[model samples]
Target: MLIILLLVVFMIGTFFGFMFIKNTIAHWLVGGISFLLLAGSVTMLTMHIRDNWGMKEVTTSTTHQIYTAGDKSAPYGMMIKAEIGKNTDNYVFVYRNNEKSEKADTNFKPDEKHISEAVKKSATYKLVDDTKATVTTKTTRCVWSSDFYKLLFSVGGEQNELVKQNSVVSVPKDTWLVLTQDQVKKLSQEAPAMQKQMEAQLKADPQKAAQLAALQKSNPTEYAKMQVKQIKQLLGITE
Candidate 1:
């Protein structure tokens, strides 16, 4: 829509060129501004489609899958398949932006130690003993200034909240983190102390084992969801 309007404006400006040949300055000014508008409109539209991320329905029962990028140039893909009460990443988030992130150029890669410390100092994630972090939304946005694109991904929801249940990997920036279901399995491995207890509980309860088998047969992703609820119940983690 906007592009069409810009094209129309460009045409009107071209018509101005013929009308104002006598006033060369007027023609030059209108023509230059129109060209910029056309270019800007094209750039914005391209970025919008490139940066779009939205929820998609799950269609598989597989426990995990890895999605590779179409190519390195368009590097990005991972979507966590989690149930809000089920699967989650036992993790803390440390964030960093580009050189212009701060008023002064820090030109430094974010250190995990510093990011972890910041998470600990925060009132929200401070006391979260459980490993899994609930992440809500994920968006990959490319910030274009003069020429280079500064791309970044944002993970939302409180630190303790289950990481986003859907796959919304940050594009090109940190695409590797959210690419596959392996992340959830990795997170489950983090709190082995708690998992050991859950494992023993499941072992003793043959009925649960049978049920889990049946559930897994039907849908592995859904099975993970059920297991997550079971573990939280055992650990007494609140919503």
Candidate 2:
């Protein structure tokens, strides 16, 4: 409606300005209208670009099931989970907190120059236009970040990471997994990535899989207890 009003105003200004070139009052009125229309259009276009193309901190969370391949020992693989729209009983949203620390003895530079690399190493994700996806959060970041970690961003600013003395490796909490709505949809569709990662791990460490299988087969009663405990933990049922 606002856009339509602007269009009408522009047409009226164009028509009147051309219709009365001899009248000083009418000329000033049309000039003022033209200036306002130009300013409003530029402002609106800037906002539109920022809203659709800019990066947003998606902190709203929803529950979804994870594929652990019956591994009762692994805790929740992700710190938070989300679903597509209103359907909560679906595949878990995948995210990993990757941290790499450098040894104190090693020649390292903890400067702003390396923040871009650090941010890249922190997560694996892609960005997309917000209009391509429909996920939204009613609450702002201040309300949505409760009990959740703040994902840092240094698009053009230098960010400092936490460091500990004498610790050989210092993996600071320098980054978080934040994605736009369309990017999240792109990621959610790649559910097979997690499966492949697990398969690769099993292939690399066959002994671990064999040990789990043997444990499950050798003691069915104990295995049942472990399974029960895992289910309770995943379900957030204390009793």
Candidate 3:
């Protein structure tokens, strides 16, 4: 819509410039400038629309902590801002670790209930201490954020234990941490090879894959269903 408007405006500008400018060189220059602007406007508008519609927003929170080597010293921690409303029913958590980054498999229908269950059952504290954290209910969603260091202090001596048990500790940045239903559908269509690649990688590196495998083993019923769904999608067996 904006592109069409810009094109129309450019055409009018070009027509006026050609009619008013007696100099051939000035007229041609003005016309060329208007055309270039029109092309640029169209390109920008197309990209804006594609980004807004093609990609779903996945809410991500990053918690950073600077831990001392051995001492339970006070570590500085901060939660990255959460994106308010990007996904229909899912959010992703992303963070950095060991100079390398990793992303978890996408989650679906991650509402307040799901998140509460995940926090209680999943050892996210092993990654970051969130005991003092509380969820606040928004008009359509729940939100929570905490200082990483404060969480650690709340954990006391059990911080290392939590770290050893959590996969959230090493999640990657800028990777799709979670996928909404629409985003998942699009990903399934466009990146069928992704699942196969992940499977092959897991097979080749059992130790490194243990983290995610542990998650699946601990929740076999849920994880199994997820795997089957992904496999069906990857094999073009959409139902």
Candidate 4:
């Protein structure tokens, strides 16, 4: 409709030009209507572009499972690692989406060529101890709300935009380890001391040692995970 209106105005303006050249009254009337249409079109276009006239921001959420990124054992159990950037405040988390998944997923898109700045501005990560089965991500962004207004300002308008996105991951309490790269490296360097401390702690408590022995015999994988979680807590490295 808006496009047709603009086209109609163009035809009227052309007719007005010829009439004006002939010095007639019809040209003045046509010229007035043409001026109004042109002014209105410009104003609507400007408003739609500058103020998002026909759109509203909406937040949508989705949830999915995630698993440990790397080996859980160099220090103790099951682990999820978030690698911290050397020069930036951002952290890169790697995780498998499900038990059957062959590859891990990162926070950014695999096809994205560059995402350092975009992640800093639009993404946030949180770790929670809720024992939930999945991680939830909420994305807030603008979308067209009025079909008529959208048609009116279809040209040169920003149809969609990302405002922000937040990901909240839930893990089992006391059984999951979330650590940074720096901490992982430091823990690796102090592994010998950590092992001695862990051995001493287990020997001094016969009940705890027996419980661990029973758990290891029943579930070796869970035992390794528990050991990792225990070491992480022992070193006070929770990020």
Please tell me which predicted candidate would have the highest lDDT against the true structure: 4
Residue range 1-239, candidate 4, lDDT tens digits = 37557756766785666566555666666666676767777777677668877789998898887676555232222333453445443445656666555665675432245463266333334545444335677887778788887676566424557766666666555456566667667767887897788789999998998998898889765785677566767678565
Q: Pick the candidate with the highest TM-score.
A: 4
Residues 135-163, candidate 1: write the lDDT tens digits. 23332222233121212212332112221
lDDT of 3: 0.41
lDDT of 3 by residue, 1-239 (tens): 33566678988877867788878898889977887887776675565445432222223333443221111221212122222346422233322222232322221223576564444222221222232222221111122123432232222332222111122332221111222345445654755477578889989999868976786669654553455455445545443
Model 2 lDDT tens row, 100-209: 21211111222357664422221112223221111221221211122111221113221222121110111111111222345435545654575577579878999977
Clashes of each: 13, 0, 3, 5
Identify the runs in model 4 with alpha carbons over 4 angstroms from their true place: 1-27, 72-90, 101-103, 109-121, 155-161, 171-173, 196-207, 214-229
Task: List pairs with backbone clashes in candidate 2.
Answer: none
Residue pairs in candidate 4 whose N, alpha carbon or C atoms collide under 3 angstroms: 76-227, 76-228, 77-225, 77-228, 78-225
**Clashing residue pairs, backbone N/CA/C < 3 A, model 3:** 102-172, 126-162, 126-163
Q: Estimate TM-scores for all models.
A: 0.24, 0.27, 0.24, 0.68
Worst 10 residues of 2 by lDDT: 166-175
Q: Pick out the ten consecutive residues of candidate 3 with the lowest summed lDDT.
A: 67-76
Flag the better candidate by TM-score, 2 or 3.
2
